[model samples]
Target chain A: MSQHPDSPARSNSGSHCGRVWVIAMHAFTQLVRMKVFYFLAVFAVIAIGSNFFDLPQHTGPEVSGIAVLSSIKSWSLGTMTLFSVVLGIVATALLLPKDVEDRTLYTILAKPVPRVDYLAGKLLGVLLLVFVSLALMDVLMSAVLQIRSSMILNQQMDFAQGRGWSAAEIASLRGDILSQGANASLQGAVFAVFLRASIMASLALLISTFSSSTLFTSIISFLIYFIGHFQADARAIFLESGAAGTGPVTRAISLVVSLVLPDFQLFNVIDAVIEGQAMPLLILAKLTAIGLFYAVFYVIASWFIFAEKEF
Target chain B: MLLAGAVRLPLEASLTGELRAAGLLPAPLAIGTRDHIGQTSSAVALGGLRTLVATFLNLRAYTFFTECRWDDVAGTFDTIVELAPHTIYYWETGAWHQAFNASSYYLNDSNLPSLRRDAAWRASVLNGRAFLERGIRNNPGDPKLNAYLGFLLTDHYKSRAFRDADATFLAASEAYRIAADGRDALPFLRRFQLYALARVPSREAEALALARELYQNRANHTVTMQCVYFSLESHANRSLIDPGSFAVSVFGSAQQAYATLTHYWLRGSEHLPVHGVASALRVLEAQLGIPADKSVFLQHPAQDAEDE
Candidate 1:
């Protein structure tokens, strides 16, 4: 709450963190002021309303009330996630540019707030907003899951009791409806995905800090997102094993290419999560660490560059 | 009789006597064939991935959301990936439908086995192989896909399964390695390094070297957060481990699903063979996780992650 610089009593280490916190809060409030959040809220509501019949047409006799509810819930969360990401990318990219455009940043910079402090504050604001959006969607999804899973369990019991059951029925019915929850890899993957998105956002922020044009930052950031994700595919091609198909130059090129881009593929564990696959915590922690490392790397890089700009 | 089951009118589905009289479509097509959401709102927009093809949703279409159609949808699969390609659930399931959604019972099943067995199989394998090969071109850092492509290759192109298949699989294994290597954290790279070094001429030594370094710089308190189900003891799960969909041999390392098919054909690893037609059924069931018993599958909402 209070920035007490060089406080020997509490350790002078992160006295600046107090300022960062305050700035982050300020940026978040601005996002609300810009009405981007309202736009997202409206989109989320539309997503929920768009679903026609919950049961997929191709499913045939498989249609059940529980299935309809699940599909709708999934659609709603998906829509929310989609809108949030779009908003995040659009909103965060505006960080540097908006300040430059309206001459708002020059005024802010006139105050005691240093450039690093400003950058960190903007990033924190974005990260917090992203977290809140994700959390809101998670709550919505988890609620639907809990309800659907419970209903399924109930219906299964009713079906078994009322119509009677076979040995196969007893075996298939596991207590945990999310059979994938049984696996560690899946759960780890979901966490990794979250962390990965954060890293992507941080990278976007770094680029935004330098570029005064919102269009350039968004385009480059989007390209980076594509390259980062597809980097895995690139390495797979150039580095095909052994001495048989490829030559030394190809291998050299592959090695160089691999190092250049972020491998966003590692963060992909959505299949594992949906399939009820096990996701070990170590996997999640490892991914989180990687994501944080990248995020920090970008932050420091951006700070170094931002500290230099003539404006 | 089938018409009688759902709709009250015997001859009054989408095709009806009027539309068929104009010769627009053949007799007795589902209302979906005529773009009627059948019983729901708008042909339900045929939601769900096309069987084994990975289709992306066009974000640009969001601007023209009302006019978007299956054919008009730009980069539909891109939309899906943009939403969140990391979710294997969405990728795997969406891809399966993209590549294999039996788009036509429209073709005569009676004419299938005898009529076009070799041709169809060849066509399927070629497309599958192409998908993997394309991934090999567009995305090479992804190691899992190479193995997945390898898995598909071994299944489709078993002729290449020579005496030194390990060397070949190693090529495919590179996908996993690059994916691992991309991490700022070295454990991911080291894990694959184990799998890589395992095949080295001097196995024990390579493993020993990698192991010692990894153990010394432990993740400390953050170790517990690594796995999703940190509580679970083992590292692999059936869903995550096998992930047997899109694994036919011909597609080798090529992730032939919605966003990008034939994820890895360049590495050329052996793929698993799920050859039965019922295997298609299994693809629909397991990969999609659509329980044959719809009720259970339906009970679970689709991805609630806001994005996949």
Candidate 2:
């Protein structure tokens, strides 16, 4: 098998890292040209629009403008989750089929390049697209949140001072407003969004290795994505079913489902963060570990299935 | 696949438990709550967009509010809080709608007969109180929710909905105390607690102790505090004390004491205790040499007087 002149394998640099980087960058540029970043405009509109939700529903100055801060976080993070997951799954699903159609896969695989690096590069490219997209959305969210939070803080301060609120009271109010605004936890939540998407992308990559078409891969990945949220519940039923005197068949089914599906509920700390709860660093680190664990396993799994596949 | 799941399942379960312990993951959705949120929202919320679905439902609740659909408004908030239980806004707004908006709507705008209207108003107020209490349970030690509970319990019109005046005041004081105990709570919460405690007949001694502590800070020497302090002190020393002298001792001067007591004496609608206030005023009037017909009591006699 002769390699194409433009292939990374034909170059003098035979390093796996170098080849993966080249392939990943190429994949990133290709996806970027698909205009995936256009979703940021919609996210901007959502983030900016969330400000108007600071409804007059508040009873007093202490709670005023708080609803709007929550609105911003909820809308922004929700949009980011939707965009990242769709981008992760769809972009990864399309890569293999597109490459095969373009004859790029044959050109790359016909050379000395290992299948694992090719697969890793393509997965990394999808992840890079998702990461870059989430980072930009995070920036937009934080900026809008900061500006609105400052306005709310100023308004609340003036009101507190006018009412002769104590210094402690003023500080407490400031703390509440700032908590709802952009902060470290919100960033952790955005990262959690990336983590969840990364899992989906890697899973899609594994599926696409044996998938007959991009449509099948995308559909199956989405079905799994939705079902993954319920994995924890299945585990709970299985674990507790013995004490509750459950039937063996039911217990077996629950156990099978629990062991087979990824428990996406662990990443749902994003909901709590949106509601003004802080995400601790240790938890975020643990979540990062889970994400990497899934991605690495899925990529290796993909490589195994793709290794001997015929063109 | 089974081996992989076996390894990750326990890890995922442990992380879920830890996240929940840290208040980072909300409890699983109850079936009733899921049913209430409907299909699309249930899907959205279950997909980890709970807060976003909550925001959308809140908008729907606003529509329910404008349409004068009070039941729908309350139901919508019930689901909203379930979706985002940690959100103070949802809790606060839910309570406000039931207690203030829905109750007021029943009182003033409902087409029901007067008797049914009154019952609806009272039920709405109680529902609001229940919602706030639930919020307090979900967010234990939260100052704002506790304070809101105190405010609801002490609200003049709403308090009437609660059957027992003494129990209502006692609960209000307890709520206010919790709020006041929180770090960085507003100064006035302590005073409000004192005000509520003073009305609880069995808690007069405790109220007096709190009042004395608050009095040590001169910032708490507002007219209501002075009036409440005087009444509590007078009650404690009822046997040996002369009202005129005690009033002078607490309020600094005959005229000042007389003016403050007279003002407090007339605010009967507020449900503040008036222990020994009438006697103090009678003694002060005699000393001030005000004629019987021209006396403060004769000029504006207490309506629904609560003399002790």
TM-score of chain B of each: 0.28, 0.93
Which pairs clash in the backbone of model 2?
A: none
- Deviating ranges (above 4 Å) for candidate 2: A1-14, A52-62, B299-308
> Best candidate, DockQ-wise?
2
Q: What is the C-alpha lDDT of each candidate?
A: 0.45, 0.88
- For residues A1-311, what per-residue lDDT tens digits would candidate 1 score against the true structure? 55443345324326467767877898888776887667556644544353343433222221234334334433543354345445656677987787787887887677666677778888888777777766665555455555666665676666665655444433344333444222344324334445656766777788887776889888887677656654554465454536357777876665554555555545433332442334456455555766776677778778889888878
True contacts kept of 2: 0.77
RMSD of each: 24.3, 2.9
Tell me the chain A TM-score of model 1.
Answer: 0.81
Model 1 earns a TM-score of: 0.49
- Model 1, native contacts kept: 0.00
Interface RMSD of each: 24.8, 1.6
For model 1 chain A, give the 10-residue run with minimal summed lDDT: A55-64
Clashes found in each candidate (C-alpha, N, C closer than 3 A): 117, 0
